[model samples]
Target: MKPPPGGLTAYEAAGARYERQPYNRSGRSGLKLPAVSLGLWHNFGDDRPVATSRAILRKAFDLGVTHFDLANNYGVPYGSAEANFGTIFQQDFLRYRDELIVSTKAGYDMWPGPYGEWGSRKYVLASLEQSLKRMRLDYVDIFYSHRPDPDTPLEETMGALDHAVRSGKALYAGVSNYSPEQTAQAARIMRELGTPLLIHQPSYSMVNRHIEGGLLDTLEQEGMGCIVYSPLQQGLLTDRYLKGVPDDSRAATSRFLSEEQVNRELAGGLNKIAEQRGQSLAQMALSWALRDPRVTSVLIGASSTAQLEANVAMVDGPPFTDDELAAIDELTGPASSANR
Candidate 1:
C-alpha cells in the first residue's frame, strides 16, 4: 500500500503550540512542562502497530505536549517502547529533538541479575546507558529512578542520580513512587551533592488522592516539581467503562486494571455530574487533577490520536466548583479503596 503523502512534512506542530495549554515551571528549575505530558507506559510497545504509536506521538507534539515519559521496563517485552520510539524518533522527530523534553527511568526489574536493577551506582548508570542506546539519544532531558530501593541506601541512590546528571547522561534527576519522608531525604542528599531534586512522579487522580496526604506538601516544601502518573486511574475515571467493561478495554486485558475494579455505580454518578458541566468524565477528571498548583503536569497515556486530542481539550474546560469538588470526593471516597 502507498504511504500517506507529505508523510513527514504533514507534521508541522500547530502554530499556537504555546497558546494551546498553560505551561508551568518545574519547581525552581528553568524548565517548563506542558499542562499534560504524554506517558508511553502503554500503546508504544512492540505489541502495538508502529504506525499507531508514531501517529499518537506526532499528534501529541503537534498539540504542544513537550514531555514524553518512559521507563526501561515500559514495554511488555521490556525496552521495546524505547526501541520503537527510537526508530520513529530517528526517522521523524530527530530534527525537533531540541524542542522536546524526553524522559526515561530505571530502578525496576529490567534484566535478570542483581546488578540489572535497583539504586546502586553501577546499576543506575548501566541502566541509563542501555536506555540511551535503546532510545538512540545522547542524553535524556529528565532521568528518573522509577521507584525507591528499600535495601539500597538513600545516599547511594541519590548519588547515582547525581552522577547521571554530572556525567551528561541526563539533564535532570527525578524519583518516582517515593513517600514524603523518602522524598525529603532524597532532596537533602541531592542538595548536598549540588543537584536539586527536579521532580517527583507519583500516582494521583480524583479516585486516587494518596499524594494529597502529605507528599504534595513535601514537594512544595522541598521546592520540587510534581508530574503525576496514572492520573486517569488506568481509564477508570473516564466514561470508557461507565456502562460496563468492554471486551477490548484495558480492564479486561491488563492485570493493572481488573474487571472487578470497574465500579459502574460510581461511574454512573460521576458521568451525570460531568454531563451537567457539559464535559465528558475524562475531561473533568483531567481538569480536576491539574487543579492543584503543585502539579507541574499530568502524565497521561493515549492509545490513539483522538484520545490525545480529547485529553488536551481538558485545558479548555471550566474549573470545578466547590460543589463539584465535593461531589467528586463523595463518589471517589468509596472507590478510592485501590492501592496507590
Candidate 2:
C-alpha cells in the first residue's frame, strides 16, 4: 500500500537526529551508514506487538540510525519482519526514503521448492521481488546473497546480485556468512560485472571472533565495508546472562543462543572490565567491535527503546586502552584464525 496522502504528521523526527549518531563510509563506496544500525531480525516479527515494533523503528530513525537490515526469513512465521517493517515504513519513513538505507537478503530457506532458497539466479532474483513486495518498497538500498551455495556456481550467485543492482531493484550488492576465499571470489565476479560487492555482513563479537583471522583482511583487500551482526553474541556478551538465563531471554527461547552456551564465568570477567570502563557490558561489547577501524558498522537488535538507546550510547564511551584490549583478549582468548 502507498503512504498516506500527506504522510504521517503525528510523529515528527528530531531535528538533531544526525547529531546524535556518527556515520561511517561503507568501504570506498560513497554510501555511509550509521555507526550502529538497527536490525529487524528479532523484535519486529508478528509475534511481537506492532506498536512496539513501530516505536523501535521511529526511535532508531530519530536517533539517526539510517540503516535498517532485514532478511526474507527473519520473523517467527517467516517474512513477518519485513511485512511489519513495511507497515511501519508506510506510516513513518515514506517521506524520508532517500535518507534511509533499507536492505534485505535472500539465499535462506523461504519456501519449499527447488527455487525457494540458495544462491541460484532464479532463487536470488525471485526472492528479491518477494522481499520488495513484502516491504512495500520499489527498491532496497543494498541487496545481499545471504550465504554461499555449494551446489550453485559462484558466477550464477554473483550474477544475480549484479542483476539486482543493474535492474534498479537494489542500489548495491553484498554477501553474508561467506568465508574469506568465497568473499574474494564473489568480489572478483561482482567487480567484473561492473557492480562491485559493497559489503559483507558477518557474525562477530567478543566471544565469536572468527572474522578477525581473515574476513577483515579480505574485505579490506576487496575495498568492501564490513558490518558485523550478533556483536553481543545473541546476548551472550551482555550482563543479561551473568546470573543465569532469564526466562524471557533469547537463550531460554531461541535456538540461536542456548542455555548451555551462557559461559557465566567469561561474562562475569567481561562485566568487571566494563564496570572499570564505566559502561555496561552491552555497550562495551559494541564499543569493542567498532574498535577495529576496518569495521564499518555494527548491527544490533533491540526489544525496547531503552535497549536501543543504551546500545547506541556506546559511541560516547571512552576508547579502549592497551591494557583493556589485552584483558579482553585474555578473557575471550585469542581470535581464531579459522576461516568462516
Candidate 3:
C-alpha cells in the first residue's frame, strides 16, 4: 500500500515501446492496436501488492501495449482491478493517457439486485459510469457489453454500447462472448445506429478453437476486428504445464484452471513442435493465434515483468510453415486428446 522507495516521480515511457512490436489496424478503423495487448484479468487485484500491479502496467506500456482490457467483474472482489488500475494510471501513466487505448466493460454480475448486471440499458450505462469512476477517466477507448443477455433484446444491449460511444463516454462500441449469429446481429444494430461495432473479444486459444467454428469468419465478413483472450488457455498451453504443473502455477491455485487439466502427455507433442521451430510453447501459441488475418490482437496477462517480456517476444518469432501448421492442426484437431 505504501509508495515505492523514492516516492513516485514523473515517469518516462521506454523509447523502445513501439520499436519492435507491430500494430494491426482495428477493423478498417483508424485505431491500430499492438499485436499483443495486456489484459488485467489476473494479478491486478487486491490480493497482490499495489506496487506489483503498477510495475506490470508500466512494463506493458513501455513495450508498446496500448490496449488494456478490463471488465466489471475482473478482480477477485469484483471492481478492484479498475480501482487498482486507476491508482496506477494517476500515479505514473496519466500524462500518456491519450497515447493509450484503455477499455472496460459491463453486462456481468458485479453486485446484487436485478439492475446489478446484464444488458439492460440501465445496467450497461450505470455499470460503465461506475467503471469510469473507478478508473478515474472521462471515457474508455472501447466499451463492451461483457456478454450476451439471452433475455434482453439484442437491440437494447447493442443500443447501450452505441449510446456509450455517441454520448462521449466511450470512443468505440463492442460486444464480448456473443455467438457468431449474435455478433452479426449486434454489428448490424450498431451500424444502423451509426456507431459501427469496433471489436469482438473472445476466448480463442490453440486448444479452445471454438472461434474457428464460425466466429472468425463472421468477424471477417463483417469487417470487425477480433482480439482474443485466454490465448494461453489459462496456462494449459504454456511450458509451465507441459512438464507437469508447478506448485505455483495457476492450475494449482486458481479455480479457472484445474490441476487435472494439465495433461503433459497431450501437450508434449505440441511442445516438441514448438522446440523444432526454435520457440517456446508460449511463444508458439501466441504466434498461432495471430495466423488468421481477422484477428487484430491477442490479449495476454502477466504476473511479473519477466513473463510479460517473454509473451511480447512472440512478435519476433519465426512464422509457422505449411508443415508446422499441419502438425499444429493435428495436435489441436478434434481427434487430438488435448483439444478442449
Best-matching candidate per lDDT: 2
Q: lDDT of all the models against the reference?
A: 0.89, 0.91, 0.88
In model 2, the clashing pairs are none
Q: Across residues 1-340, which tens digit of lDDT does each residue of candidate 1 receive?
A: 2243324344556777777878999888899999999999999998988888889998988889989999999986999999988987887778799999999998889999789888888899999999999999999999998899989999999999999999998999999999999999999999999999999999988778888888989999999999998888899989899879899999999988899888888878988998988888888888888888999999999998999999899898988899998888887873363546
RMSD of each: 2.4, 2.6, 2.2
- Give model 3's clash tally: 0
Name the TM-score of candidate 2. Answer: 0.96
TM-score of each: 0.95, 0.96, 0.95
- Identify the superior model by lDDT, candidate 1 or candidate 2: 2
Give the Å shift of residue 136 in candidate 1: 0.8
lDDT of 3: 0.88
The segments of candidate 3 whose C-alpha lies over 4 angstroms from its true place after superposition are: 1-10, 334-340
